[model samples]
Target: MLYFDESGYTGPDLINSKQPYFSLASIRMTDEEIAQIKEEVGYCEWGRELHFKSMYKSYHGQKILDKIFNHPLMDNYHVLPSFAHKRYCIYANIVNILVETMYHFNGINLYEGAKNLILANGLHCFAILHSNKDLVAEFENNFVGMVRKPSIESVANFYRTTDKLRYDVDTREGFFDMLSEIPPTIQYIKEALTHKKFYIDLTIPLFSVSIQEWYNKTKVKENVLFDSSEPFFANIEFMESLRDMEVPETVVGYGKGKHVYPLPVGNMEIAKSHEEFGIQLADVFASALCFALTPRNDKFVKYQDKIKSLPIFQNIKLNIAPSTNDFIEARMKETAEIDPLDFLCEHSDRININKKSNI
Candidate 1:
């Protein structure tokens, strides 16, 4: 079974500047494998008696860290400060390692190598679970004999009600708290009981890491206008494009104005202008993707510098232009006069224009 998800987000941080990290995590495992992992972790045996907090102290102490650090898998991946800063890096590194461990056990990575394995084996009716509806649609469009199911409710409920005893202390309590509140999706391989033969593939993460490294190392330049704020909010034209493409399934959960939760194409609910949302999204994506590739938690500024050095990151940034002050002011005015929904629905093609006639 393939369970895919992205993490490190709680709510849209349009106005707030405190939270620093956002990420995505995907896990692929069979029912039996999940059970076996749970057993190995003593989660099944301990039941609710052991909470994540206590479990971390009891099971994954300094001794466990030593073992993991010395393990062969640690050769390429470093455990020290996952990122640049000391505090944030530590937390980020721990989460990265945990996700890495899960992927190692299941032989899957971010680049969809596991799915390739399933496809190569003539596997059909593969279940794909993800929180992002757009991602689900993308997968469905690309793959034949694939089934998509929304599991946000199930995953959220599990995190909410499950006794903390089942998890480790170092686990972000806020993550569990948020998961308990939001809906999550889960995917799996169908008819695995009948066809037990399967091969586990483990090259995707390396591929992603390598690609990221390559991107970071490469350099290119282009002439581009600055539209800083557009990347944060969902552009009306972009949303229309997706809809015209017959991709409305990507719109899941209640969005603010025309802006959706998981995808770009909606407005920033709290911000005075759509441009702000674009900036925020750009920052979030840059931070998350960098964290994913680097496996080290660095501050946003430092990460930005590192990303600037990468070819792919440079390409992405080059595409992002800063919003002009005139655009910002006009958006603020528009937002003040209209209800978000009405504005989103009615002003589809309208870009805010300043009365001053400044470009």
Candidate 2:
């Protein structure tokens, strides 16, 4: 069976300054192993639900985290984690477009304009620029040079250092930095447009696809148990959709030639708390992942180093697809040479925000 939980979900305000990650994690186990987990939790005196966020700061939480992270059985189970960072989304598409627009207009780099504005006011600068059509008009009027110049370095540098963009010349060094940051950030943005079903709707197929593949190898049909915090519609609709419809062949990575199984959630169950040992452990695992990926909020800033070093965090697997938006994908393809998975792994240990302190 599969037990799962969600973390860092903030609806459509996904790019919010403090919390900018949305992750869904699932842990697959057999019925026999789940019984063992219940026995383990009972030994720890965790008679009721073991909420990861609640237990996280307590002595009990750390002990549990250590237990699950090192468990030989758990190490064997498949842990599927799918997540995305919003700021990187902004950088890969939103900022890239603006940089390309500003770079070639009579040599009056709009990237300089974007940098100066963003440094002073953060990403909200985009709203100001978007609102001010007059700025674009003024630049166009003064243009004395050619348009449509392809300057990938200028765009990468704008994303790399907002402050330095004003004083420093564009260099090849920032190109590597920008490519290193895009992989974990490159999923389809459409998945984030809604708040009600943010976690389940977006991640169900991803989890199911992986689970099906595992079943093919082991000949075990895994059922799913989700923490009850998920919206009722998500629980009901996801199960119904999986049974009634074909998993949409979209950017969600139902890649061709791979054995596609109809993963109905007929066996899916939802519980209100960590009362179920499987759900509880899923909570712990999901929360740990969310903490590692999300931007630092006030509550977590103090524990940054400790959180990163947690054993559960050591070997995380992330799958993020490029934005489905054509414009963004075109720019992303032209701007970076490195692979997305490598880039995300390199930056996985800490938040990728430049203005923030490194964790």
Question: What's each prediction's TM-score?
Answer: 0.22, 0.52
lDDT, candidate 2, at 5: 75
Tens-digit lDDT track for model 2 on 108-205?
Answer: 43322233223212332332243344432222221101112223443334333333332233323433343332222223222221222322233543
> What TM-score, to 2 decimals, does candidate 1 have?
0.22
TM-score winner = 2
lDDT of 1 by residue, 89-198 (tens): 22222222223334434664311322222221111111112234343233222221111121444333333333331143433444334223212212222221112111
Q: List the residue pairs that clash in candidate 2.
A: none
Off by over 4 Å in 1: 5-7, 14-18, 49-359
In order, candidate lDDTs are: 0.27, 0.47
> With candidate 2 superimposed using the best TM-score fit, by how many Å does residue 281's alpha carbon deviate from the native?
0.9
Question: How many collisions per candidate?
Answer: 42, 0
